[model samples]
Target: MLDKTGDAEALGFDALADLLNINRVDREKARREGWRTLADLVAVHDLENSSERRGDEWGAGSPLYQACHVALIEFIRTAPAGALPDPFAPGEIFGPKLPPTLTVV
Candidate 1:
């Protein structure tokens, strides 16, 4: 998910959220307020400060950093090659736009 700020570095979480349509209303409001901007957000350097999830499964940014991370644990778990879409946030429904990062059998 990309950040909220229009900044290129922003998580664009709003965009990801938009593509998936998970937190539309809540997120849109944030976007409008500028609170979601990459600059507005403080980067977390540890899992504790980062997202609610942990591990290298996604963009394991420190607890906080200026970047996006995966929100679909199940998708990662069930994806044929970890390229599946997030169940709650649809979009890549068309399929991966890029190749899977690693090869799995």
Candidate 2:
């Protein structure tokens, strides 16, 4: 699902629904109104190049909007002491993540 192309020319969300036999606008309205289906729950994400209405909503940070700040802070902390500038702090809505793998040595 990670479209590395990030092609802005790709089809809009509703146009895609039409191909799947659902009217796009109607589907979105229903989802927004809380009538989401299993497929809706899966497909409704902060996708790249969303419909004209969505207009690039989610940036480098996912919908939670903390990764960018975290990366910035990490970058600043790693910088040389005298050259480092105060970095912008990420908001306090962080959560746990899946841990990396390891093996007994």
With candidate 1 superimposed using the best TM-score fit, by how many Å does residue 9's alpha carbon deviate from the native?
Answer: 7.0
Q: Give the TM-score of candidate 2.
A: 0.23
> Which clashing pairs does model 2 show?
none
lDDT of 1 by residue, 24-105 (tens): 4545554575654333333322222322444665455543342333334444666696465464443355544656579788
Q: How many residue pairs clash in each candidate?
A: 17, 0
- In model 2, the number of clashes is 0
Local distance difference test values of all predictions, in order: 0.43, 0.43
Off by over 4 Å in 2: 1-64, 85-105
lDDT of 2 at 22: 44
- TM-score of each model, paired residue for residue: 0.22, 0.23
C-alpha RMSD of candidate 2: 15.5
Instruction: Give the 10-residue window scoring lowest on summed lDDT in candidate 1.
Output: 42-51
For candidate 2, write residues 4-101 as lDDT tens digits.
Answer: 55321265554444443444555666557663332332244422123324334444423322344465577787878768533343432353344667
